[model samples]
Target: MEKDFKEYITPPVMLVVLLLAISLIFVFPVLNMIILGAILAYGIRPIARIIQSKLKFESISIILAMIAVLVPLILLIAYIVSVVSGVLTDFLASNPNFDINAVLTQASVYVPQLSPDNISTTIGDIAKYVANYLVGKIGSIANISLDLFILICSVFYFVKDGDKCYNFIKSFVPDDHIEFFDKTVESVENVLKSIFYGHFLTSVIIGIFGAIGYTLLGYPYGIFLGVITGILQLIPIFGPWPIYWALAINDAFNGNYPRVAVVLLFGFFLSWVDMYIRPAISSHHADIHPLILLVGFLAGPLVYGIVGFIVGPLILGITYVVLDSFRKELTESK
Candidate 1:
């Protein structure tokens, strides 16, 4: 009886528990990176495979597919850096000699009984403290560089041996729930594809209009601001609003009313794109509940910073899909 019980656990239950404990231990470092890497690989693999199938050259296909993914990212970063530098130079050149205290005093008009003097002093103090605190912060750039290097190493390994690693890891799941496990994976993939594709297309469309409008109006950082505004459009609600408002406020402070007016008009048009165009396009890929997506979006930054933006939603979507699958499976089995 004792031997039979031991053998029973050995066949599956013991293996399951052991794997679960290991997964829990390295969940963040290894599993998280692997999952992210797999999703990235999955997204591009089809294109690579298509090329290989047509040309019978797997190596060339892989190289082309990698270039397609990597080159745009490098260019995008370079563009951002260049634009930011230009904007900073432009801002410094424009000498706006306005009293910050006076602006605060004027703002207290609608909300009477507030002391503008105290408010101005407090604002000035906080601003000084913030500047000092930022100066005191050390080695953030170095830390970021190190993290990027680590991520690149992980990504390379993942792309190379991802399938074998995934299979080995996934093997721990009980045979009974294997189908459910597969469903969870598909759900995650679907969510990622939906988010990436929807955001990319929408941003491109917005960038086209934004750039054209900014260029015609002769905004100093037209191309830069346009691209930044379009990228920011990925965020919900107050997405493009920040860039538009920043440009407007910067122009206002510089006494450039014409520039402000042009940017404001551009902002209004962009809102229409965000409110109407995105939902229509995204629905075709995935019928995500706006509320759920909104919650995930807010939670994403809190939990995992930038990576969490996509990872959070993917996690939620997979959980929801897996639970649904389990329930359906149980019902049919019953």
Candidate 2:
């Protein structure tokens, strides 16, 4: 009885406890940054290897690869920020009084609850609340900056020493479970590559087309709206419908019926493209189910925040693959 207790209960319990403690100590604090880094690392590793082969310096290749990934992202963010700022400034400058009363009066026709008498007080209170909330979020900027720094460092390390890191992780697994680990790793890489490349390329294509459509329709801030539409495309099911529909309503409100029709038709076309193109790209590469991708896309942002968009689907795919592998192994054994 003592020997059996030592062999089964004690060792397993101790291992579980140790793992829990270690994870709590190391993972909880930087989990988001780690996930972001891992995703970027996996995506950029091949490019880094290609550069390294030519340059003969691993560190230089990794840095160049990081730059290749980050430069366009930085430029896009800057452009979006400038567009938003200009739009806001123009609105405020044009409407010196910024008539909340007129807006509320118009809104009350639809909402039926917004009284013009209370509009001033209600808008004031809401504005104050928003300002306060934004101010509070400002405090987190430092933490976000720190996380970004950590992400860059982690990505560099991952690209530079990915093999060493893999081997180190592999050492922790039991010999009997090594094959499981290897299979999981392969499946994860395939899923991530499919998701990152396939989905991103599709979004970019839709965004460019949406931008062209909006521009042709003489929409204000068309580029900004197009970029937003592209970003929204990352969210499965939701896609760019919300933005396009809102634009259509705006056009209808302004008595631009023809433009509204164009917007609606263009939006529907984009939706169709998404439904068809996304699956073809993802399936051609990873062969993952559309439902799995959808769940991951929706749940990732909800659970993990913005970065969760990528990591969420990835975790789901990995889990599915790992479970499928286990099922096959068990069946073979039986």
lDDT of each: 0.73, 0.86
Query: Highest lDDT: which candidate?
Result: 2
What would you estimate as the lDDT of candidate 1?
A: 0.73
Candidate 1 — worst ten consecutive residues by lDDT sum? 28-37
Candidate 2's residue-wise lDDT over 17-48, tens digit each? 99999988987777878878988998899999
Top TM-score prediction, candidate number: 2
The C-alpha RMSD in Å for every predicted model, in order, reads 5.2, 3.4
Task: Tell me how candidate 2 scores on lDDT.
Answer: 0.86
TM-score against truth, every candidate: 0.71, 0.83
Identify the runs in model 1 with alpha carbons over 4 angstroms from their true place.
Answer: 1-8, 50-64, 91-150, 157-185, 246-265, 330-334
Query: Can you give the lDDT of residue 130 in candidate 1?
Result: 92
